[model samples]
Target: MAERNNNEFEGKQKNIQILYEKFVILNRDLLNFGVSIEELKEICFKRRKTVHTVQGSQKNAQHSSFIVAVTVVCAVLISILLKIIFDSIIKNTLGTRCLLPNNYFIWEATRPETNCSMCEDVNSVLVFGNVTRDEFSNYAYSSRPMLVKGAALHWPAMKTFTYHFLKEIYQNVEGAYESIEEECQILTFKTEFRSLEDVFAMPESRVLLEEGEKPWYVGWSNCHPDVLAIMREHYTIPHFLPEDAEHAHMDYIFIGYQQGAVMHIDYISRLMWQAQLRGHKTWKLVPPPDCDHICSGISFRVDPGDIVLVDTRQWYHDTHIDAGEMSLTVSSEYG
Candidate 1:
C-alpha cells in the first residue's frame, strides 16, 4: 500500500507540470497579439493626423483666394465715377460763352476799339422824297444813305401784302428758306426746302422772337422766280432809281416778330433798299473802317410807310423789330 501511494503521487506531479507548461505558452501568445494590436493603433493615429493637416492647408488656401477677389472688384468702380464728373463741367462753360456777342472774350480782346467813341451817339439818317434819278446817282456815288418817306405808302401792298396773301400765292410752290436747328453759332442758319403751306403751318413756339432766343425762320425771295414776280405787283419801283434799275424788283422779304438779321456786312455788289410796310424796326449801322473817322455808329427807327436806301456792302448792320406784332419788309437791290 505504501508503494502504491508513492507512484500515484508521482503521476499527479507530472500532470501538474504539463498544466504549468500550457499556461506559460498561452501567456506568450497573448503578449505577441497585444504587441501587434498596439502597432496597428499607432499607424491609424498617424494617418488621422496627416488627413487633418491636409484639410487645414486646403481651408487656408480657399480663404486666401476669396480675399484677393474682393480687393480687385473695388478698384474698378472708383475709376468710372471720376470720369463722368469731369466731362459735365467742360460742356457747360464753353457752350455759354459762344452765344454772347458783346461779351465774347475773344472779340473783346482782339477788337477792343470796336465799341469806342466812334460808336457813340450819332445823327439821324438823311430823309428825301420824290428824288429824281440824277439826285439818286449823286447820293449813290457819294456813298450816302437816305430814308424816303411814302415810298410804298400809297402802293396796293399797303393794304393787301400780308402773310396770308403771300401764303396763298406760294401754297404749292417748292421753295427753299433758311432754318436754324439750334441756338448756336455753328448751326445758326441752314437751307431747307418746303412748300409755302408747310411754312405757314409751323407752330408759333418754333418761331422764337423773344430776347436771347434764336429766330427759327428767315430767307430771301430770290430762290423762286414765280414768287418774286408775284411780290413785284404789290409795290412799284421808286422813281429815284434809273430806268435800267426799274426792272430790278424787290428780292427779299423779312417776316418775323421782335427779331431781325444778325450784325453782318453784305458782300453783294448792289445797293439795298428796304421798305417797311407793317411794323416798326430799328436799324443799327456801323460804317466801314475807312469811314469810321467821319461817321460813328448810327441807330434809327423805321416806321411803316418808310423806305431806307443803304450801301449794305460798305456797312455792318443789324435790325430789331418792335415786340407787339410781326414785321413785314420788302427789300430790293440796285446799282
Candidate 2:
C-alpha cells in the first residue's frame, strides 16, 4: 500500500509538472506582456498576481491590458484546479481525507526552503529533561529537533484531558459548534468521524475503547477563542520557548486509541511544539527530497510528559502511538 501511494504521488507530481509546462506554453505570450517566469510560477503556484508595467505604443498598452485581464481569470482557474489536485494528492498520500489547517497551504510542495546544511550530521533528536529559553532557541528556527522530557509535568491537561473533559471544554463555550461547522480544521485520519461534531457525537462505547469497538485517531485545531481560552486554562506555555517567539492564536488537540497521522510536510508559519500528555508514540522523520542524498532519516519516541519541538515545515513526518494507551497531545506553533 505504501509503495502504491508513493507511485501515485509520483504520478500526480508528473501530472502537475505537465500541466505547469502546458500552462507556460499556452501563456507564452505573457512573457512578451512582461510576465517573468518566476512571477508566472508564483501566480500558478500561490495564486498571487504580480503587477507588471507594459512599455510600448498605445495599441500595445491596450493589448497588454486585455492580456492582464485574461491572466487574472486564468490564474483563478488554475488555482482552483491546483487546489483540487493538491487536496487529492494529500488524501491519497495520507490514505485518509483530512483538511489542512487554515494556515497550511500547498506552497510547500512546489518549493521547500530547507537548508541542507542544517540536516547535516543530525542522526537523531537531542534530548533533555528540561531546557531554558535561550538554550532551546538555538534549535528553534532550524530543522534540528529536540525532545524535552517532563515538559508537561505541570500541565493540568496530563490528568484532565480525557474525551469527556475535552468534550465539555467545547460544550461550555458558546458557538463552538458554529465555529467548527464553518472554519476549524479537523484531521480524522483513518476514522469515520468526518467532523468535530461527529467526533463529539460518537457513542460512549466507541469513544471509551470498550470491547469490540473499532480503533480510531483524530485531531483538530481549537479555532474558537473561547474554547482555546478554556483549554489554555489547563496548561501553560513551555517555559523553554524563546520569549521573543510569538504564539499562534490557535492550538491543536490530538487524541485517540491507535494509528496516527501520515507522513507529510507542514506548510506552517512557525516552529511547532507538541506535549505528549498521555501514552507513547514515535515520530518518523525524513529530510526533504533535495537533502535525501546528504541527510539521513531517523525515528524517535515521545513518551508521556515528553515535549517534542521541531520545525515540522522543514521535515516530512509521520507518527503512530503505541496500541495500549490512549494518546493525547496539545500542540501550538510559535514564530
Using lDDT as the measure, the top candidate is 2
Tell me the spans in candidate 2 whose CA falls farther than 4 Å from its real position: 1-109
Q: What TM-score do all the candidates reach, one by one?
A: 0.53, 0.69
Query: Clashing residue pairs in candidate 1, if any?
Result: none
Q: lDDT of model 1 at residue 76?
A: 35
Per-model C-alpha lDDT, please? 0.58, 0.80
The alpha-carbon RMSD values of the candidates against the true structure, listed in the order shown, are: 35.7, 12.5
Residue pairs with colliding backbones in model 2 are none
lDDT of 2 at 67: 54
Candidate 1, residues 1-335, lDDT tens digits: the string is 33454565555556556655754564454344432434323322222111112255765455344333422332333233334334433444334422343332543344323333333334667787776678766665334557888777887888888777776766645542221112212112222423334556665554444555444434444445666667777887776777666344337777766667777666555778888988898888887565577677777888898899877666678888887567788877776
